[model samples]
Target: MLLRIDHVGIACENLEEKIAFYRAAFGVTVVSQEVNEEQGVKEAMLHVADGEGGGSYIQLLEPTGPDTPVGKFLAKRGEGLHHVAYGVTDVTKAMAAMGGAGVRLVDEHPRHGAMGTSIAFLHPKDVGGVLTELVESPAPRPEQTKLKNG
Candidate 1:
């Protein structure tokens, strides 16, 4: 059901500080950063090198407003791993199976994810006290594919 480990979501209060830290610590480059209003968060993605083997990415998630999900998470957990995202080939199918078996979801349908993917969240109450994310890719972007083909 799961294809690979997608990006891990980390909760951060100041994205610039975190970005600088990550850049200096791991030498990663920021690929994109955007605010997703529907999901209610601002996110920054730091790309990892392909030849360095395959850990996905560094996703810096900041709350959009004082009442957002990420905001609540920060209030509760402080700065830490917010969620573990698992890549699935088919999010709809995967979510259906999980739902049929009584898993609680944060969303019924997948929403826009960073890096051109679809995403859904599983409630922490149903996942052994840890929040989880299910992500489905919409095929790699053309330039990304070219990087692979090269």
Candidate 2:
């Protein structure tokens, strides 16, 4: 089942500048940052408000190259809200339901996402012009904790 609004993603050319803006404007700092080579982007997650366990966040994305999807999006649209992600209990099941309902999907199957979550995207044309993502992030793995500490 779809759980909650996970985060709102924003595409940008410069991560540091935008990070500074958010830090100053909202008093928020990035909680986590990573470069997903598979996605060809560097992303930072900043907590906006506390949720039941973790919190909701704003995900800042900076494309690694002009060939990446986010890079193409920035080149065309000039940096803005890219997608809204919803947390899900099972991304595969969610995608199945969406496909059965005739929703166009960007991903035919779930793939590893930032922070080791499984994710899939629904095409914007099928979802009222908003690119939507389903994310299923499990509890932090042991390696994740180690990386955070060291």
Candidate 3:
């Protein structure tokens, strides 16, 4: 079982700068900032006014090292849409289904992603050259998020 689009990952050379740009331009509010040493990026999540949970997430990513994946992505493709993350009910089962159908995955299991979500990525080569992310939430529903945060 899968949910809806969790968030879209955007690769940027500077996380804060882009975060500011988004905040000013779109009126989006920064919800969280976290450093995921495992993913090799400093990420900031911007919450859109579309209503609850992760209504539409805008992520600003800056690489931790020159050779990190985001760094490589920047070197090869510059800053832009990095991946489209879709929310899944169960990361493991969703990944299994994708694999059985011959989907190429970037991770063997769900890995730690921004906002404490369990996430996995499908290779662009297998998904029509568009990198797809499968993310599973480890928290309450959107309605709950709205209630708690508001």
lDDT of each: 0.83, 0.86, 0.83
Please give, for residues 83-117, the per-residue lDDT of candidate 3 as tens digits.
Answer: 88887878989999999999978998789977678
TM-score result, candidate 2: 0.88
Write the residue-wise lDDT of candidate 2 on 6-72 in tens digits.
Answer: 8899999999899999999999968789999988999998877654433568999999999999999
Per-candidate TM-score against the hidden true structure: 0.89, 0.88, 0.89
For 1-150, candidate 1 gives per-residue lDDT tens digits of 776677788999988899999999999988889989987888998876432122377799989877998999899879889888887878889899889979999997888898778889998899998788998878775446768788
Candidate 2: residue pairs that collide: none
Off by over 4 Å in 3: 49-54, 141-143, 148-150
Q: Against the correct fold, how does model 1 do in TM-score? A: 0.89
Backbone clash pairs for candidate 3 read none
Position 24, candidate 1: lDDT = 98
Summed over model 1, clashes come to 0
